[model samples]
Target chain A: MKRYLKICMAAMIISGLLLSGCGKKEKQDPDSTSQSGVMKVGMVSDLGGVMDQSFNESAWEGLLRAQNELGIKIGYLESNNNSDYGPNLESLTDAGNSLIWSIGFMMGDAALEAAKANPEQKYGIVDMAYGNNTPPNLISVLFKSEQASFLVGYIAGRMTKTNKVGFIGGIKGFIIDSFDYGFHAGVNYANADVKILRQYVESFSDAAKGKSIANQMYQQGADIVFHASGPVGDGVIEAAKEKSKWAIGVDKDQNSLAPDNVLTSAIKRVDNAIFNIVSDLQKGKFAGGATVVYGLKEGGVDIAPSSDKHVPKEILSEVAELKTKIIRKEIVIPYNAKTYEKFYIAKQ
Target chain B: MSIKAKLTNWSNSAKRYLDNTFVFTLIAIFIGLITGAIILAFAGFNPFESYWAMAVGIFSKPKYIIYTIIKATPIIITGYSVAFAFRTGLFNIGAEGQFIVGGIVAALAGYFLHLPPVIHAMVAFALAVGAAAAWGAAAGYLKARFGVHEVISTIMLNWIALYLSNYLVMSPAVKRAESEATHKILATARIDLFGVWKVSEQGMAWRMENRFFHDLLKPDINIGIIVAILLGVMIFLILKKTTLGYELRAVGFNKDAAENGGINVNRSFMSSMAIAGGLAGAAGALQVLGVSLECVNLSNMEGYGFDGIAVALIGGNTPAGCFLSGLLFGALKYGGGKLQSMMGAPREIISIVIGTILFFTAMPKLIRYFTSRINQKREEK
Candidate 1:
């Protein structure tokens, strides 16, 4: 039994060594290297997968844009669990990708270590700035989704036929709080008499809870609703469809998902920002020393034109004017829908 | 051979592979692959092509291999941490907290210490392990002294550990003030070795100049792998051979019976938690000393603690089994990444696969179908 056990152990060790050995040999092949249009881009998604339809989807869309326009060989590893973060980033670096993108705040540390280990590789981190002060190969893509949410609130305030509007948010972190505040700030700016309801699901994945909250909003006379609940917003759309109510969308142009109910969407433009950064890298214009804030001015955030057949023409024209004002430095839309609306709280 | 000896030989050789966790893990991989393929195919992508692409991406590159092993290190340690608790009849969900606390402590040590790389790394790692073990002992004491349910206490401890870690980073103990994180650890505490991506000009120059690190081994794998594997062997030998190991196993098998037999079950319980926490803390320390290079963030849970439960279960709560399971999980994660990127497989495929394996593994009758089939094969042979 002892001899047999020894042989079994030896076999496993040999196989493990051989498997890892073979894996390493393949990574060293020169055919994988590239420059310019041949440059490769890699991403490590947060806990969510690429089709998360929020941050990951938008990021992948940006990479897809690079793949299409610049002919970059793009790849991404979705992190199913938290422990995989470091390894996922390392694999991308080891694969010799010139640039790697990591979404969400969690990847900040992992991305930093990977960048330190691979100084020649450029990295872009979303949601938060990554790395200590020294690494020159990192870029932070910070978005003022607050700005877009603020503008969308204006549209929601002006377009509400029932005098009541609602906002559904995912997670109550400072970031989401910013989204809430900016949204209410826009709505309050647009209409004083309008009623607004708010609820947070405390999760990015609970679409059912999103729908339930939207249902409550719809029942309480909210005609227009906006959701910044990541994939959970899919539930908001479902609730709208179930009740035949109006909804606003955010992150990506989610209007198409619920065309009958969606009035307009606050576009986060993550795809555009990602593509822009990658394109700059390809053109040797990659800026590493600062945070790039993509707001209304850079066309990094905008409302996707309401393609729905139901949007009132007057509301659309009014939103266009609001957009112009927002872009022209004429309007600095306040963030925080909750607090901004306190003096002018709108409810049934 | 005599009939009795031949029968025993036949059973011994045949029982080995079926009893091994890695073989089951491989079976799980195929099971996961098939399920993933079906779901993916239903979603309009070619399962075969996707799996092939994942294979090419993960295995076709040397970095993927190094990265996978790097990932395997923590899993192995956490697995032993969890498996140790189970062996003493305690369910420890607090490994996550212990890991986080240890990580934060190691991060601090990494930043302040000014020593040689090996010694600096060792001191920082030791502090982390001590913190984790101390934390675990709290729950053990509560359970052993007052008869509190370890399950409930450990669960609560996990939350305490999380909030405590969050506080550490937010407070001056670890806070960088203007920066959310503390300053980067001094260079001595970092794992300076590089396998494929060397940041140091001297390291690269040394490699190019004399092929030093390369002449012996790849840098990315690290010395931690050896520590993890050694622990696996040690755990196996100690549990099978030592008197203390026997007492612990006896307590695990039947606490009341062991207590009646003159073994102090309560003492064993407390010791078990301390040891478990130490292992998890060690895992966290190794990350700073081996991979993270002295950086630890305020993560709610590093996911290793949760996955450690899966490793313990997959390994059937044995040390060697946990090690093998850890490696298996590492492979799944490594391959899963390459799979997602190249084959367009959803990243959630890894979870789906693990979930499926867990579901089946939980049902012995369900497993019996396969093991029985293997037995039939042996009979025919």
Candidate 2:
């Protein structure tokens, strides 16, 4: 038995070594593409995958736009988790993709590392801004989804029958907190007496949790609930349908997901950012070093047009007026609760 | 010799090969690969090219090797956690909870404590492992004292760990100001070897000249890999050589018999679980101080704890087996990105392959049937 075990161990080691030796001889040949003279663009999706019908999907649409109009060849890898980001980026870069786009803030560190490793490989990441000194080969794209959420909050405050609005957030972070605080600020801006309740589902994918939380808020006399929780927001819409209350959508115009129930969506144009960056890269005018802020003024953040035709024209006009003031620097929107508290205190 | 005699001798050799556990494992592996190939063919992909790309992707780049080792380090400990419990006749589904608690404590210790470099890492590690062991022991106590099913309790504890860690991260004292994660671990607490490298122009020039060497020298390759291997060996020695190990195995093989023979079965159960938890806790602490952004910023469980179950299962419930299996899983995970880009395949395909491999490994009846067939041929001859 001892001799047999030794032979087995030796065989295992030999096979393992042989497998690795075979890999070394291959030298990794890059896949050849038929699209001559077209720039190769690679997009790496977050764990939500490309078919998420939200942020990741919208980003893919932008890449599709570049593929069709700008004649760039596009390939996408859907990351399974946070750990996949680095490997996905490296694989895309190794495959001769000159420009790579990584969606979401989760890829911030991975993209930063990849940028440092291959200085010539240009990268664009969504919802991330490197403080001050970003790598010269990377461009961080950020959207003021809070500004759009603020507009939706104003609409909710204007339309609610109970003078109470609710917000369901995905997780606690700067990005998600922006939505929460902006919604609160907007509700108070519209009506200081309006009560704004808040809760977080603590996940981007748990729609059932989102539904239960939304139902609780509706039970507490909140007639309108806005959610910034990716697919989880779908559950909020479902709960709104059950309660016959208004639900605000996010990321894209999700009105079509539940037409009559959705008041409007807080649109963050990930597609536009991706398309614009790829276009710039193609045109030899890529702005790499600087962080790009895509806010309401940039048309990268806006409230989707309401599918409900009966939306009061006066309310629409008022929102448009507020958008102009925001663009003109007359109203500085708060992105966090502390700043919003200052605005609330000053009003008092 | 007659032809029948020669045929009998050949069949006898075949039976000897079939009787070897190592050979049976290799056969299972071969079948698993074939199964993966069949699935890929049905899915309209060339299995050879895809697998080749995966192999090259992981080994062709020096940085990729480091990444694979880094990825394997945590799972290796977690695998041992599950394997150790399995050997003691306990199911440690609570490895996830133990891992999370360990990470939370380590992150807190790393952020709050001030000590010299080596001492800081050691203290943080000890705090994490001790907390995790206590957390795991609670489940063991519930089982021994109240006869509660550990499976149900461990599963419940996983959710508790998740929410508890989430709450801790949100607290003002633990949370970094204006950030989702806790404040970065002090330099003294960092486990990366590159942190201790002396700065010199010669070193800088050498790094810049060779990209591969520069990557190998980066802080990405943490000391956790060495710790993982050492722990694996330690567990192996304890299981194979110690008196306590003999008692633990006896209790595992037959708790009633071991108790009748004057063995402390309850104590064995608690100690085994505590050890398992310690391994899992070490995995969590190493991950936080070594791998993650140097702080715990997990919105959800990282899934390494769950993956350890698969690693232990594939490793055949032994420390050395767990280590090797952990490395295999790590390579598959790190290579999946290449498979996606090169073959236009979903990364989910890697899961299918791993599942198939485990399926084969778990099926003893299949191996028995093959061995019986060879025996029948020998008898006929």
Candidate 3:
């Protein structure tokens, strides 16, 4: 009887301690009621996590800006796999975030499903093109990344002394396919005789594989290599430095990684798009249920600054003119593999 | 001896079994939970709230419970793979590689085969299991033939399987149109939720009409969990009630003795590894057939095999224990996601807690010391 009583007492004490552990000291008077006017923004990252220095990172920068300038509360969840997209978005919604941003095309299905499930919640996804049947609360934001890739490709085509250049892609998806096709069109536009080699490392984070592939391309007479492989592009720049070749980056300006070897970057302004969307939302102009295309005309995509001394003055001017022509729709560069044939046939 | 003495002897034996593993495991779990609470407190999060949220998160919603079960299905099989190998005195770190091979085979079979509804899914799963068995047996053969440690062979095999799967998935023949995954299998081949036939028009009509039944059963609950639990029971029966299992245990107890006693030790090693591989393959098959619906486009290890090791260790290498431990781990994983959103803590802390649990579970001395102290105090009182 004594032993049983002792055990019961111990159990009671433990439960008491455990229950007290939930004591709240600094919860800020229940977040939703106090911050009625302030907006709550949530961001979901792709498989590359929050710090990939690419699309996810750029989107996070936009969220941070909104928090600092607009006085909005922000939270982010990083996904380790594709399956996490739906759950992460749902979690953010459950947290009562008014607006959510999903980064990358891989999130299209998950975001679409979530948007369908919760028609009242507002969502904006980057790089995912929703045709005509998009949910009323979800907005799809697309970037004409090819417009930027074209300028960099033209530079590569003209700068290659051996008449050979290369392109390295992270994965064989629609977005990467756009970069590849646009680069092909640009190379053909510059010099049809130049050879372009392509390789996919099949991952966004494999820097070593990126370096090896870039090195091999450089060794095989390719003087310039452009990569759309996120962090893998850093390795490409590293290879370019070692081999005295030029490397073109993607998503953002990466010339700082290797100032001398990096020719330019195919810059896609994801941060600008995100900031503009949230800013518009703040101003009571929440543009939902529409596909917003950020193209060259909108300054959504561009070639980063590269010195004329590195790229020939004539080639630079020609590339700049080509960019204007593309913006004007005078030269419609192919954004996908199927459309590339028509462009190629016209060039021939 | 009298009847009382005989009853006491039986109770003593039962107590011995509990002392050997069960008590230690329970104590370990208690310590691990307490440590996790302390860590949460140190991190300025409400430990009770986080744990309560995790518990309620996994059980409060029917969908969450189904999700937990779904998550457990594959790991349960993989845990069995590890547990079965351990019982045979082999460390099967190669479950990961074997699972990948099995997953790839299942994907291929699911895509290419044109059989009827039930037959197609079963055939695909069986083919996957066979392929994974072959992969596992190859490592075992190497260990038997050239004295290569199963550990090294399995690790190397895992890398080979990863690269091989990657190459195959990327090939033009297998690669899906404009996507990283392969083409989705025919509806006939899918092991859909509730064992519902997904192909025939009649089956579709029936399933649509039975929406109430589906809801009652929880539409998200798939056949994988059923298969995992059934396999666990069958494995337990096999180990306890069969001559083959008896021989296998003998080999595990003393390989040289088993060999001298006319049991082929080399054959046991090969067969045990093969069976272990088959279990892992079942996990892979269930994952592709039921969960991801493709090879899942993994750029790195999917972690089921590695998690299996933890499940097996915590389970004390028993079939029934593996099933329960698998569920526990799965609950942690499923609930961890909710905990992160609820408490705003990093999900990595869940992994740390899991690791701490495994650490405590591995140390039987800690449990023995505590239990002995408790017993001494009770006697003194």
Candidate 4:
């Protein structure tokens, strides 16, 4: 009887905690009937939900802006795992969304399959290009992330007092290789004597690993660290706060995470690209079967506004100059090891 | 009739009803629904409408039902693995590792082997099951030889299997060029029903004429669910009728008694683990051949094996119980996503409801206590 009483008590307490803790609910827009001409845009997020504070967040922000400024009806479905991708896309299609967006490169194959199956529906994917085989109804959004990484590298190169900087990547892949090579090129261009330590967390979500790697680099006399490793950068910033060193953010303005310790962010304007594409759809100018690349010249990437707070005025001016050079094609930023070598020889 | 006599009669009937497992399970399910409704209402959504939408999501189309069944297949098999071990008084926490080992072997065999169409898939399935059985038997061997607790050893093996699979997926020899996953398995290794013919032009033309069959085959319709059901029936028979089953159950009841009665206790442990591991490995093989068709680098455990524990508990460690509970869970999972899509409700609510149900189902003692208390109050009155 005592054991029975204990079990009963435990059940009641667990249910009570759940009720009290989950009372705060998210605000949702009331369901509206789809009008004949009103375009409904639906988005499917990857495993990272809309609040990932990175790529997914930026895409969601863009959708919200479209809802406000363009007066379009917008909805989104968050995926729980890889298997959810196809079904989520199908649900949106069945709901009569005129345009659908798949967030992240991980959803590339799913998006492609969905587009092929439903040729009448227009689809777009972020950070994935199908190259020559892009379907007639799909648009691929690509970012010249290397161009943005170069500007932040310039800042780190100019500001480091220890003449040693570090680069932390999420995974060793084509996407991350661009960030690595671009940072290395920028560092060399600014100060040839400065050394850059590099490491890959091999995972985007492992913050503990990221923090440890950043700590080690700082201990090795690196004054600043730059990371392009999604959520792992949060740990890098925390490490920077602890060590009183500099950390550069990626994807969005993350100065709020560590304020004084964060020098700046390499901002990839996914929101801008998404907003522009939706605006094009509104204007009856859907550019399907094509890959749209956004570089510094296209106003798709830039340094965060918070850069001026930490970076010296002269260094900011130099970064602005470098940005112009990249835009004008006067400086060709390397995005891989082989290209980086050629760029290095040309600099010499 | 006096008031006291009538109250006693009512309490007696209520106690009898609570003693029935089926009725008790229904009551637990009712409590879980109420909990979900309360959460939904507090979260600014109409609970009735949300539940209506979830039901519609599952049953509105044949394809949806097919999809739910597809999702339930692997978990059902894994649940059997857990139930099989539990019946023999062994905790098989290593089902996750065995499942991964099976998947890795299946993917390798599917990709590298070039056999006849039916034979290729069968060979891959055989290799996967054998590998996982070996993986499970290793833990049993340690327990028999060195008196190692299976719970700790299996947990450690789970991590090793995860990292080893990851290493294999990343190796250039197995990795697909320009992708994070392995190469898609060869066409000969696919186990989908009419997979090759379904997408052909002639098949599409035929599908246009047969609307029902088209919708039924819309998802990756495979034989996995059928195989899982057959396996459940087979396990039920084996446990009920076989001499081996008697020995395993005897060991589970009392090892010393079983040993004195001439049963080989050590052999029973190894055989029980091997069979459980084989069931888990079959799940991975079927998933590879029927669903994803290749292995992706897993960031974390997929949780199928973990969910198997819940299924086994809810099932009362019976094969039939696992099958039913697996379907229940699969429907909840696949249908729950519709709440977010249709009504903008958060997905975490589904987890809460499932957790609450599992909690109630697991604590039969609390239900018995409440029933007795009610009887006591009635007698006092």
Candidate with top lDDT is: 4
lDDT of 2 by residue, A65-120 (tens): 98899888788898765556776787788778878988888678788877776677
lDDT per prediction? 0.74, 0.81, 0.82, 0.85
Residue A247 of model 2 has an lDDT of 92
Order of models, best TM-score first: 4, 2, 3, 1
Native contacts recovered, each model: 0.17, 0.21, 0.22, 0.09
lDDT of 4 by residue, B163-192 (tens): 899889878799875555778889899899
lDDT of 1 at A86: 73
For candidate 4, the iRMS in Å is: 7.4
lDDT of 2 by residue, B161-266 (tens): 8879878876778776544566778878878776434123465556677777766664356899889989998898888899888888898899999999999988
**Could you give candidate 3's per-residue lDDT for residues A122-196 as a string of tens digits?**
999999978887878998899988888888888887777899999999888888988999898888788888999
lDDT of 1 by residue, A22-137 (tens): 55665544464553338888998886568877888999999998899888888888775544677678667756687899887657667766665555778888877533473688
Using lDDT as the yardstick, the better of models 1 and 4 is: 4
Query: What would the TM-score be for candidate 1 when compared with the true structure?
Result: 0.67
Summing lDDT over every window of 10 consecutive residues in candidate 4 chain B, give the lowest-scoring window.
B8-17
Q: Which residue pairs overlap in candidate 4's backbone?
A: none
B1-381 per-residue lDDT for model 1 (tens digits): 799898778667756754665565555555555676677678777665555556675565565556667777888888888888888788888888777767878888888778886788778878988999998888899999998988889889888887676566555556553333456677677654553345455655565555444323333456778878877887777778988789888998999999999998888888888888888888877776666653333434667788888888878788877887787777766777766655555656656755765655544445547657866896899
Relative to the real complex, the DockQ score for model 4 comes to 0.20
Q: Of the candidates numbered 2 and 4, which has the greater TM-score value? A: 4
Q: Measured with DockQ on alpha carbons, how good is candidate 2?
A: 0.28
Model 3's CAPRI class? acceptable
Clashes of 3: 0
